[model samples]
Every structure is written in C-alpha cells, then in structure tokens.
Target chain A: MSLDFLAGFTIFMLALIMVVSMVPGLLAGLESSGIDYDAVAYRTGVILVEDPGWPVYPPWEMNDEVHKDEIERIGLAVSKDTPNILLSTKVETFFNDSFFTPDDYRNLAIFGDIPYSYHFSLRSLDGVTYNEETGDPLPPGYGYIRRVVKIKEPGVAVINGTTFAPQYTSLSSNQEFIVRLDFGQLLDPSVGAAYRIDPRTEPVNVTITNFGAYLNMTEPSTNATLRTVTFWKKDPTRPIPQFTRIPFAYGTTDSSLYTLTIDGNPYDLTPDTKVFDNDNISLVLKPAATSLFTLDQNSILDIRFNFGDTPSQTNITGIHHYDYNSTNVTLPDLQTGVLEVAVW
Target chain B: MVNDAGQLYTMEGVAAGVIMLLTVYIVISTTSIYTPGDTHIPDMQLEQLGSDVLAMMDTPDTNGTKSALETFVNADDDAGFESMFLSYCNAKASGAADDLHMSANVTYRDGNLIKEHQFLAPDNTWTGRESAVRVTRWVQLDSQPGRTTYAGARAQAVLVEVLLWRA
Candidate 1:
C-alpha cells in the first residue's frame, strides 16, 4: 500500500460520503411540491372566505360577462370587515358556471403557478338554502381546507293586509300603494354592510298577502285590477327635492331583472293582473335593475303600485316605509354553513 | 517488511472509512421521507377550521345585536355555548354532519390573578388521546353581577379558548 494510493482511496471515500449526504437535500425539494399544493389550497380558502374581493364598491360579483376581465378576485364574504360571513348574492354569482368560465375561477380564486385543479363547495346547515359547487372531481390525494361560515340572506318586507288594512285602507277613489326605500337611511355609514340593505347589491322583496281585508266592502266585486308598477326616485341633495318617474323597460318581461307574481301567476311590471280576495302579490326587484337606475346613497326610491280599476274595487293606498323597523321588514338571522376547497 | 512509514497511510485510510460510514448511517437514519398524509396539512386544516368557527360565532348577525359568543358568556350559558360551538364546527357541505368535539375555557383577569373557568365540559367522546387544536377569541363583557362564572363588577375583556378535535 503506497502512501499515494492510500490518499487517493481516502479522497474517493470522502467524495462518496458528501454525495450521499446531499441526496436527502435533493429529496427535500421534491417533497415540498406536495406541501405546496396544500399551501395553495389554504390560500384559496382564505381568499374566498376572508376577503371581500377587489372592486368592492361595485362588487366583483356584479360584473357581467363582457366586463369580467375587470374583476381582480372572486370572494364570497359580504364585506372586508366581516370575514366568514358570505353574501347570498355573491355566492350565487360565484357558482354560476354559465357566467364564469373555469379559467376565470382559476385566475381569480385558485391562483397557482402550475395551474392546479380545484373544487369548491358550500352547503347551509339547514340543507335547503345553499348547496353550490364548482370545478373538477377530486382525486385520491389533494390539498383540502374547510371553513365554517354564516350566509347573510336578504330581508323581505311582508305587509299582511289583515294587519295594515285598517291603517292604510281608505275610501279615496284613487288607490296607489307606495313602498318607499330611503337609501339615505338604509346606506347609512353607521350601519355595517353585514346588516345594511343596499339595493345596488341585493334584491328588494315586497310581499302583500291576504288581500280580502283590503278589498272594498261596499262593492260586490271579488278582485281588483293592478294596472301598473312604476319606480320614482328623489335625491335630497338636489336643489329642489321632488320624485321623478324613472324611465325603464316596463313592458319587457325580464324575470332576471325583476319578478312580479300575482296569485301565483308570474307577471311583468306592467301586468294588469287581477288580484283576488284570497290572493297575494309578490314583487322582487333584483340588483341588476336597481343598478340601471343610477341611484346614489342619498337617493330615495319609491315603488308605487297603482290600482287603476275604475269605480275603485279596493282601498289599499298608503306609503309602506321599508325601513329597519322589525314590523315592516323581517330580517332573517345569519344562517350557518360550511365551505370546502380542494386542490390537486 | 518492516516498513513503518506505510502504517501512517493505513491508519489514515481506516480513519476516513470510519468517518464516511458514520456519516452515511446518520444521514440515512435522520433523513426521514415524509408521506403527504404525515405532513402538517391536517393540523393546519383543523386549526383553521377551529379559528373560523370561533370568529364567526363572535361576529353579530345584525349591527346592534349582541354576538352569540358574547351573549353566551355574559349569561354563563354553558349548554347553549357548547351546542352552538359544536353545531358550527360539525356542519358539513354534504353527507352526515362531521363528528367534532370541543371543550372551552374562559380566561379573565380578576384583579391580579388571571382566572380560568371551565365554560364548556368535554363530552364522553373526549378520551384525552385525540389531537386537538386550540383556538381563542377576545370577548368584551359589560358589567353583569348576576353571571355565575364572571363575577366581575366592571367591564372587562376575556379570552375564550376552545380545544377542538374530530371524534
């Protein structure tokens, strides 16, 4: 064994040991890829649950197909301050596959470097209100995250004729029932978005039931004709504050914008539907139509229902203020729900 | 062959071999290849879920209304708190509700001593063997003399700590 040969063998052994030690470091980088998937899923979950998304004033959910590129992110939460509290409208818009393509979801919600596949689902505890999902099927191994949330549903103003007949019904020949929405009071800065009623973001539901009490007792008629439903707006900030009729496509029967159902029969805003004594009238004004009206925070919106039956068959005529009064509007409690996200 | 000079080289070779073998053994033993399941993903999920449930419970549904968490703590409604917490935690998107268990403690500063009161007792499923995640929320309470757990006469802030686990 020459000294030169011995030293060469020792150097070879040292090189082999160093290479073996470096093997673990190489494997570590590979193992991190799996963990990275979980990290992406977790980030997507946080974005959907905690964030209110970009372009918040005119919420990202409100963007239509043509303007979809303007949306920077997709989130379900009602507002920035209220995390884990989702808005029903935002949820509906996010899960609408027709409106948003798979690419849109990947770009907005599940932002990842490798174009990772994703699955998102949300179900209300009650099992009826919300059951929505999007994306591809799950594989055997996937990064997953689940968040418990509360769904904030819009309130409905229910005016039972039996309760309001005595106060509103009059002998006046002109019968006009008005439901006033004071945006100043509704969009007050003091009120949080979780509880605030913004017509530009949510639907306005007005239901009047038990019409027998409102029917004129002197007449032998069993029903009254609902001629037209018109919208009027007044801005208090104006030099002379006075309500002017808002011009809209009242003749077009667009259920997407607004829905008017009388006696379980769907009708347009201009429907001259006859309302029976035992029937109910429901008007749902969606946010899409409200946005078309160009209303500001200080604007006052009035939905007037004109009963133009000659020789007036009904006496239902008065302004129904749709304010925060519990008796006028019934705001539902925040419903508990679970939202899950999976990435692979 | 009385060549003592080669002995030093022989000794050096043996020393290098020993060092190399030890390094190989230590690297092989310590460098554990972790499977996806064994990673901290499950812990992160559970911790996030627990934190979300606590946060949602603390938020009020309406602007002026009292949050469910504050109401339960102010009234010392242990049963109500337990049921609410479990309901929120166990709710699922599909299939049967998840099997989740929870135990809670309210920590408040009473004068100089930080007191901890058992707000919710663990159910029978709790065997002390489950991997539980702890989540906490700060709750501000107004002076309520009638409360049994918080006998404080002045307004104070308290921490609601909950240990959550899947049964």
Candidate 2:
C-alpha cells in the first residue's frame, strides 16, 4: 500500500465513528414524538371511560353557561366505580358542541402541554340510540384508542290505563291525577348511580297510556279535557311541611325545559287540549326545569294533572307513587356502545 | 534496515480495516430502525379494549340482577360468551364493525392443583401467527353441581382468561 493510503483510511474511519454515534440521538428524538402521541391517546381514553368528572355529587354536567368555568373535567362514565359504563345524560351534554367549545375539550380532557387537534366519536352497536361526534375530521396518521362501553339511560314511568284505572278512577266530582316523586326514596344511597332514578339529573318521563279506560262510562263521553299540569313540592325538612304550587311559566312552551304531548300533539304544561278516549299523554320534564325547583334530597315533587269538565268526563283522581317498583316504572336495559378518541 | 517497513504497513492496513468494520457494526446494532408497528401500540390498544369489555360485561345493568358474564360462565354457555365478547370487541364508532377473534379459558383451583379449562375454542381465523393479547378477570362462583369442565360443590374464585386478536 502507498504511504498516503494509510492517512486517507484513518480520516474515513474517524468520520464514520462520529456519524454513527450521533445517529442514535437523532433516532431517539424522532421515536419519542410517535410514542408520546399514543400515550396521550391512551390516557384520554381512560380518563373519559373510567372516571366520573369532578364535583360528582351535583355532577359537572349540571353546570350552566354561567358556571361553566367551575367544571374542571368532563367525563362520560357513570361513576368511578363503574368503568366503561357511561351515563347517557353526561354523554348527551358532552357532545353538545354549542355548550362545550373545542377549547373546553382540550383543556378538560386532553390536558397535554401543547395543543392537539382531537376527534371523538361514539356509536351504539344497535345503531339507533346514540351517534355523536365532535371535533375535526381525522387525518391519516394520528394516535387512536377505542373503548367498549355500556350507556345507562333514564327509566320511564308508564301509567297503564288498564292497570291503574281501578286504583285511580272513581266516581268523584274532581278529576285530578297526580304522579308523586319522593326524592328521599329515589335518591337512596344504597342504589348505585347507574340504576338510581335521579330526578335532579335525568329527565322525568311520565306516560299515560290507554286513556280510554279512564273515561266516564255513564255519560258516554268520548273525550276529557286536560285543563292544566302543575308542579307542587313539599320539603319535609322544613318546620311546616306542606305541598305548595311551584311557580313556573306554565303558559310558555319551551321545549328545552319540558315537553307536554296530548294525543300526540305537543303543548306546554298548560295544555287544555281535549284528549280522545283512545289517545295518550306524555310529559317529559327535563333536568333544566328540575334544577329550577330549588329542591333537595328530602323534597317531594308532585306532578298534578287537572282534568276539567262540567260533569267530570274522567275519573283519574289518585296519586301514583313513582318508586322503584318495576310495575310502575320500566327501567330499560343498558345499551352497548363504542367510544373512540384520536389525537394528532 | 531489511525492508521491515512493508510488515509495519501491512499491520497498519489490517488495523484500519478492523477499526472500520467494528465502527460500522456498532452503529448498525445501536441505531435501531423502529417501524410504526414495532412500537406495540396496536397490542396496547387491543389489550385495553379487551379488559374494558370484560369489565363492562361483568357489571349488571341493575343492582340486584346477575351480570351477563356470571350467568354465561355459570351455565357453561360457551357460545353465548364467544358471541358477546366478539360483539363488544369488534364494535367500532364508525358504524362499521371490526373483525376480531377471541378464545377463552377458565382457571380454577381444584384441591391443591391449579387447572385450566378451555371455555371457548378458537374459530377458523386462528392461524397461530397473529399477534394476540391476553386479558383476565376474576369471577366468584357459588356452590353448584359439577359441570362438564369444572367440578366443584363449594364456592370458589375462578379466573377467566381471554385471548383477543384482530383478524
């Protein structure tokens, strides 16, 4: 070999060694970005599926537009004890983009150092109950995580005409039907939140079916006039406990607060519509209206339905206690759903 | 000097070649090329999904009712277990269901021996090469008659192990 060959080889070897040592550091830096994305996605998934947001008693979802800043986190799970089980009310509110801006989701759910564009979607396996999506369209390369969950929906109390006719209908001059909700019993600590009938958070659904059974038989009346529906509350904790009429805008038909349907026609709480014997009545009192009642756990709420006619066209005059009895209220099964979270 | 410089030059050349070869070898081994799949992100996602599905199945819709998992396991209903597990794991938020396969086993203590019984057999999708994740849950069983696989008349705790893989 020539004498110069040794000098050239030595220079090449030293340069190669320097480059090789630096390669590892470069690769590690690149690898971290990929790993961090996946880690963030996993963390977000766990937070949403396994946690019940802060201030769980009143629930974070109950915060109105004024108190929105008080909400620290937003979770869909029913409670911390029941992971992968979501509350339908929380799910509904969380996906309401108008109520929760994209910044809310980033600050509450993602909690990453740098802002990340996120996409969240939830779909029920049955394909009808829930199909909610919020956030931007997905990009090709993004961190993703999917969770299997069950959604707990609010139960509905159905007052079957045939079953309650004998108990409620009577030959009295007054035609009044009352559905009593005992908050003390309904919010018992023993019952899990997943199954508890919480009037404060869930909608109070009362449906009266088979109206023909309660019509006046002697007068051969084909229909009865539903004069007004009023809400009354009694606080047993108070020194003098008695049912008093709750002040509300009964004439204003606000679908956001409550929905009163008679014979399949939507009306306000003061629906004076004449119901045919074969018709049905459904009253859905949303949580927004319930929160306005200034009620506590000990308060007893009564939904009074007054039917007015000259000779009492209907004889539905008894208080139906809305308790845990399966006969009165039917709790639907937990619906299966899938939730996906992606971060980029 | 009897041309001893040639021997020294050959020695230098060999040393340089060895040094170059060693440097290349160290660099190649130290700097690993990690593909996206090598990160095991899919495995982590699959495992988490499997565990969540099992936990949700074990929770009853109502307070006093038996969970779907307990009922199926107690009755030795393998078919029901397989279908429910697949339905939960394969469900996607895009309205399109994914294709996932699973097999399960029940591990129980009989006397002093730990025994494993196959609860659900793998379907035709099993090729033995797919990457799979294992998730387990503990189930309490009341004293009952001896069944096909598990034989016990006393209350005991058993572990339900499931192997999940994307098809």
Q: Best DockQ goes to which candidate?
A: 1
Give the C-alpha interface root-mean-square deviation per candidate: 5.9, 5.4
Q: lDDT tens digits, residues A1-344, model 1?
A: 56656685777677677767777775664466667778888999999998988878787877777888999999888888888988999999998999988888899998887788888899887878888998898887688788999989999999999898998799974789999999999988787878888788889999999998889999867999999999999999999999999999998888778999998899988888789999999999998899888899899999999997878899988999998888899888888889998898
- Kindly give the stretch of ten consecutive residues in candidate 1 chain B with the minimal lDDT sum: B30-39
What is the docking quality class of candidate 1?
acceptable
The local distance difference test score of each candidate is 0.86, 0.87
- How much DockQ does model 1 earn? 0.38
Best candidate, lDDT-wise?
2
lDDT by residue for model 2 (B73-144), tens: 888899999888888889888846789999999999988899988999988998999999999998887887
Q: What is the DockQ of candidate 2?
A: 0.34
Tens digits of per-residue lDDT, candidate 1, B1-167, equal 67766566656666677777777667656555534444467778889999988888888877688999999988889999988888888888766888888899999987789999998889898999998889999999987665556646778899999998888
Candidate 1: Cα lDDT at A224: 95
Query: How large is the C-alpha RMSD of every model relative to the true structure?
Result: 5.1, 4.8
Runs with alpha carbons beyond 4 Å of true place in candidate 1: A1-31, B1-30, B33-39, B123-130
What root-mean-square deviation over C-alphas does model 1 reach? 5.1
